[model samples]
Target: MAQESKPVAQVDVRNIGGIDEASVTLPEGVSILTGRNATNRTSFLQALMAGLGSRQSSLKGDAEKGEVTLVLDDETYTRTLQRRGDSVSFDGDPYLDDPELADLFAFLLENNEARQAVARGDDLREIIMRPIDIDSIEAEIRECKREREELESEIEKLDSLERDLSDLETDRREKVESLEAAREELESVNDELDELDTGIEESQTRKQELENAFQRVRDARSKLDNIEFDLETERSTLSELKAEREELHETIENAEKPDENADRLAGRIDELRGRKRSLDDDINELGSVINFNEDLIDGSGIEIYEGTPSDDPTDALNADGQTVCWTCGSEVGTDQIEATLDRLRELRSDKLDERSEIRAKIQELTDQQSSIREAEREIERAQERLTAVETEIESTESRIADLEDQIESKQEEIEELEQDAESIDVEGYDESIKLHREANEIELRIERFKDEIEEIDDEIDKREAAIERREELKSEREELASRLTELRTRVDRIEETAVEEFNEHMETVLEILEYENLDRIWIERRETEVREGRRKVTRTRFELHIVRSSSDGTAYEDTVDHLSESEREVTGLVFALAGYLVHDVYETVPFVLLDSLEAIDSDRIARVVDYFRTHADYLVTALLPEDANALPEEYAYTESID
Candidate 1:
């Protein structure tokens, strides 16, 4: 039974197809439009499709423009079709942002590619996979990979920084303890100096002079040590820079030259791109022609057009019962048209394959070009680095020479100061001299400890800052990991889900329909290598295999050609349903429009509708009176549209 509380989706049509003006409200669940062939049922459906963002609708023959307005979810969406010379242009916001998915899956009409592909023995896999843009997905995956790599690198650096935190803290603690101990020793030495007796003032003066000389000698020696350390550090750096320069020279010499064929590859890629554009134009034209013809043959009467001549009307069918070709007004059999459409379809498929091959060739050539560019850049970088390293070596050597001269001058000053301290006349003031030397040494120790502690504090601050950044880097890396996983599995997930849905639904439908001796009708997704241009590439193919039980109860394989029209139609619908589910179209559009189920018997049609109804919020189907009667009376039914 239809849910009374379910929200209604309202549609208003004006000058669309044969519908001049009409408004329809579709409730949730099944809504059957029970009418004869030309009661504007398909036109209403087309109008509804236009409102849903499908470009498959047409303007009325008598009107230059048409519009369809859809009101659902308390929101209004409008689509306008304007006739321009020979072609129609569409404008206005519609229900969907991109209608490709809805057109291929949600809008199930008589001439729909999904439905017709099976009838015409077309590539079912291609039709099902058409809505997916593989190139975009692959490009996104590549981008995700790059981001993940960068995140990983940053995280690694953070991890290394975190490992050094403990050592930094320990070093800071040791420096602080040493600073405290040195301050205590200096305090003790100052107390002892204050406790020294004031007797022998002259001796104290001589001791002070000797103390000054000793202090000068200590300062000179400390300066000399620092200069010598600087000289040694500069000498080490110079050696390293010289080694690096030699390595850079060797790398530059051994670097391979960039490929000379890059220009040729670029030209070839450009040519292929041009060919692809041409193929796109050709494919689009053929698709338009096929759709127009299919529309004409399926329902839209030629007499609906204002300029077309229809004197006898019956003359539209020749003596041989052939349709008058709309393009040339020549008598052409429907079979011939179908055959022509098949050829065009095959040609389009071939062009697509050719385009794929060309794309692969372009990618290959582009990769080669990238390699060549990288090689050239590497050699240039090596040469530049070599020159910089040579300059650094010269600078370092000069610095080392300056430091050595400073060290020699400081050492000579230290020796002269030490000799002066030793020559001091401190025979009676030896004790005073000893006290002064001890205090001076303690002060120097305190200064050295303070400097070391400051350096450790700076290092500790840096390490703590780096540790704080580690958490943020970890969070970013986790996000990148999730994105990478999603990107890597998107295509495979869709493929698997599509196959699973199709097989599961097919099994259930076959059971419900109770086809005699039919064991199974399942689609197997397989990959096989096929020659595309000069190269062989792996491509996915959907193999529809049928198993039937013979009279002896032994099951055997059967081909698609052996299937009846009703079976093919049902199979195609199931395939379309699989795509609809796989793409999650229900989230995008609420309505699933079904039309032209004339081939299936009424009972089977009812079962099929019943099967499909549960999958959608609203299942609007067009059916003949008899077929409509087979459905449950609980479904919403409309006999005529005004």
Candidate 2:
């Protein structure tokens, strides 16, 4: 809520200070009272202060009776000061009677005094930050800070919980990986067992086939033996042939194989080398183009281009007129030159990389070619041995064929005898039986690993739920922090704006009054401690300082004590006016009653009066005729007091 302006309509005074009786008509703005010493100017202003609820006014000269009557915008109120015995009694309107107004009046009276208390090194904060209810604001701020501290502590605890949750998550991840590996291994084992079962079945079938072939060989042997001496002679030759055939088989198995791609690798090397040469040429061309552009930009080849050198190379090129190309000496546009330079730089970088890569590939192919040549030589020796072995095997097989023909003719005679014989005992069936047993064991182990993985999965889900609860706590703490920030910001803004508004008006008034040696005035909020009985209480308040510049180009700050007597009076008045403005005193009492401002010079007094005319609706100042004449012509209301 804003304070509305209530200008005083009139005032009647009797037996107040030096005033015996006086009735004054106050205009809307800037009313001057001209009087000599002891003409009751001070008394009249005092009465005005008292009528506005100042407690400082008293009955004059022990006359025992004084009263001030004030006519405000809506009502007439009178305050009478009466002395009975040793005490004084004040009677006035109860609604208008406010102790706060008395404090404001006291500040103004102190401000206008010739020996200003602020100028005498009193605490300036106590004067300027008045009517702010600092005690109440400080209490609320303290409570807010306490609550904020508690929230911060809780947040720290939650952060610890979050760290624990993170550790649990890490453990869960490791367990999950372990479980996944176990499951994968179980699946691998299962597949291996399945393959083993198939291998066993195939082995059993092959065992039966070997038994059949062995039985035929035995029958043939029996038939050959039947042909006595002839079979014996033929068998000796067959033995020799079979021994040679065995040697050939061993030789063929040990022979080395040749690399079929030896020729292909050599051709790739050649192709890469040719590409590398081409890339080198491209790179060289790009380098020349880049260097030519650099020379043009650097002004090293301007004479070759038939253009004069300028401080800035880009400025030397003209887009409209005929311009010679720096490298080709052909007429070209400026845009074309810039585009060519940019393209050449890009091409140079690309070609350089391509050339390096091609060279590396060429080196790799050369190494491969050397390895292939060594392999080819080894293969040539192995092929010669293999060919000799094949020739020996063919000769041995020819002798064996002759012997086999005779044996087959005899075996036909013996086949009828062997058809009645039982099948010979089969061998190599033990390995298949052993593999079947192992597969059964592996299948059992796979089932156990799967069960363990399921148990680990359950533990991971529980840890994830705990992490969700931690997140909820973190979100609650964040809300508390936001609210705390808002509270602190509001408190600071209120205090800052109050001091800032006061300083702004104070500096403006000081400038208008032409206060010398003072450039700026402001209030600084500070924290201080005072002793209350045996306890120390900390308080926050404002302090005043004035900035002044010396003749030697140095700036310094000092309190109001550094000001002269008249300067201090002006400072005090300006400060008082600033407080009045900050607190919106004009709404309650729209009059600034000032008197005995003779210490201030006439020019400054005129300016101060002019300022009051705009800020206050009723400006009543007590001045001598000389000081009154200094006021502007617009302030025409003046009353002479006798």
User: By summed lDDT, which 10 consecutive residues of candidate 2 come out lowest?
Assistant: 106-115
RMSD of 1: 5.6
In candidate 1, position 235 carries an lDDT of: 86
Question: Which 10 consecutive residues of model 1 have the lowest summed lDDT?
Answer: 298-307
- How much is 353 displaced in model 2, in angstroms? 86
Which number leads on TM-score? 1
- What is the TM-score of candidate 2? 0.44
lDDT of 2 by residue, 96-213 (tens): 5664533453324422321243565544444444455544554465556666577667657656655666665666567557656655665665576456545543556665554454
How much is the lDDT of residue 185 in candidate 1? Answer: 85
Measured on C-alpha atoms, candidate 2 has an lDDT of 0.60
| lDDT of the candidates, in the order given | 0.78, 0.60
